[model samples]
Target: MTDLLLPLAFLANGLAAGVLVGTVLGVVPFYMTLAADSYVRAHAFAVGRYDPFQPACLLVTFAADVAVAVTAPTTAVRVLCAAAGLAAVSVVAISLTRNVPMNRWIRAQDPDTLPAGWDMDAFRRRWARWNSRRTAVAVLALVLNAAAAVALP
Candidate 1:
């Protein structure tokens, strides 16, 4: 079970981290450059598809990490898996609390006109910040999982 879980954890973590890093490095930056109306259209188009996929990947990653942490053969592997689990938790928490709300708001916007007093620049910056945070934690989780897998006996 431990053997099966460790590889599953690594694969899921890789998927989660890859998407996040891509968002952090490419998608967000591209969105930041777009005009307000364009941003609204692009943002709306980009988000809905991630709904069940990314969240599901993160869920699998967290579950596998927790299981590996408990059943790992060595102290180092256990600690690494536990730390990765924590990082995975952080990624989900930050996304739910920070990024998802803004995504919801943006998705609701009209492409022809933003809401009254909508500060497009501020929203872009704040969204980028939250994305970077989640991306960092996600990448950290992947690295920790890789290290844990390497440490496996």
Candidate 2:
């Protein structure tokens, strides 16, 4: 069980971290630079692309981490996996509470008919900040998973 789960955890964590860093580096800065109307379109497009995919990857990481934590032979490996799971949970919680709502709001907006007094600047800033937080946690989860793999028998 440990043998199977450790690799699965690593794979999911890697996928989650890759996408998070990609957004943290690529689409986020570009979207932030766009005007409000343009941002709505681009942000909605990006959000649609992610949809269930990113969330699934993060969930896989958490599930695998939990399995590894229970099944790993040594205390060190188990502890590492548990820590990794904690980080994975943090990433999921942040996405649910912060990023997902902002993404949904952007998807619902009509670029041409945005409500008056919409605050794109603050919205983008808050979204990016939450993204950065989750990205950092996902990356840390990857590192902790790696350490667990190394500590395994």
Candidate 3:
């Protein structure tokens, strides 16, 4: 069980990291290049489609980590898996509290036209800042999960 779970955890973490890093490095930059209306429309479309995967990856990472921690043969591997789980939980929390709301707010707007008094620059800045934080947390979680996998027997 532990052996199976360790690889599963590693795969989940790797997938999560790939998605997060890709958004931070690729999607955000591409959005930044677009005009405000285009940004809103493109993000609304992309985020609407993309949001589900974030939670799914986090769920897999957490479940696999928990399994690994419980079934690990040694104290060190258990501790590492627990730490990786904590990191994954943090990513979920941050995403739900910050990123999801922001995305929702963006999605709620008229993508073709700005709302009265809406500050596009401010919105972009806040979204970018929150995304950077999410990316960093996810990267940390991925690294910890990888380390935990390597630590396993």
Candidate 4:
């Protein structure tokens, strides 16, 4: 069990980290961006008022991050994963501070309570900047985890 411990932990950590980053980049951001885009396209009139997909995806991402951190092979790997998670949290912070405010403004101004002059340029620029930072950190975490995996067994 001791022999198996390191490798198994590494594998689980790798898998969980991969899932966490993948979902953040592939699933949650994709849907949220799409929903935001759609809302803007309809002149700030979102039919659903809120997107159910974003919360679900966020939940999965949080769970995956937790799993990876818990199963990491070493203290170093756990710290790296935690740092990567912090990068993602920064993205969320940017969203809440900048993007969300923009969204709220859009909602309030477009088509009566809201105005319909939203151009995707500014939003895309901000989103991409934050997302790229997050991606870089996530990639670093994965690379570090991979190294740990190779070293374990």
What is candidate 1's local distance difference test score? 0.87
- For model 3, the superposed segments whose C-alpha errors exceed 4 Å read none
Q: Return the TM-score for each candidate structure.
A: 0.96, 0.97, 0.94, 0.44
Better of 2 and 4 by TM-score: 2
lDDT of 1 by residue, 77-133 (tens): 899989998998888899899989999998888888667888899989998898898
Better of 1 and 4 by TM-score: 1
Question: lDDT (0-100) at residue 120 of candidate 4?
Answer: 57
| Top-down lDDT ranking | 2, 1, 3, 4
Global Cα RMSD, each model: 1.0, 0.8, 1.2, 7.1
- Model 4: weakest 10-residue lDDT segment is 46-55
Q: Output the worst ten-in-a-row residue range by lDDT, candidate 3.
A: 144-153
- How many residue-pair clashes does candidate 4 contain? 8
* lDDT of each candidate versus the true structure: 0.87, 0.90, 0.83, 0.47
Alpha-carbon lDDT of model 3: 0.83
Q: Sorted on TM-score, highest at the top, how do the candidates line up?
A: 2, 1, 3, 4
* Poorest lDDT segment (10 consecutive residues) of candidate 2: 49-58
| Residue-pair clashes per candidate | 0, 0, 0, 8
Best by TM-score: 2
Query: Which residue ranges in model 2 land beyond 4 Å of their true spot?
Result: none
Candidate 1 local Cα displacement, residue 15, angstroms? 0.5
- By lDDT, the best candidate is 2
Residue 81 C-alpha lDDT in model 1: 88
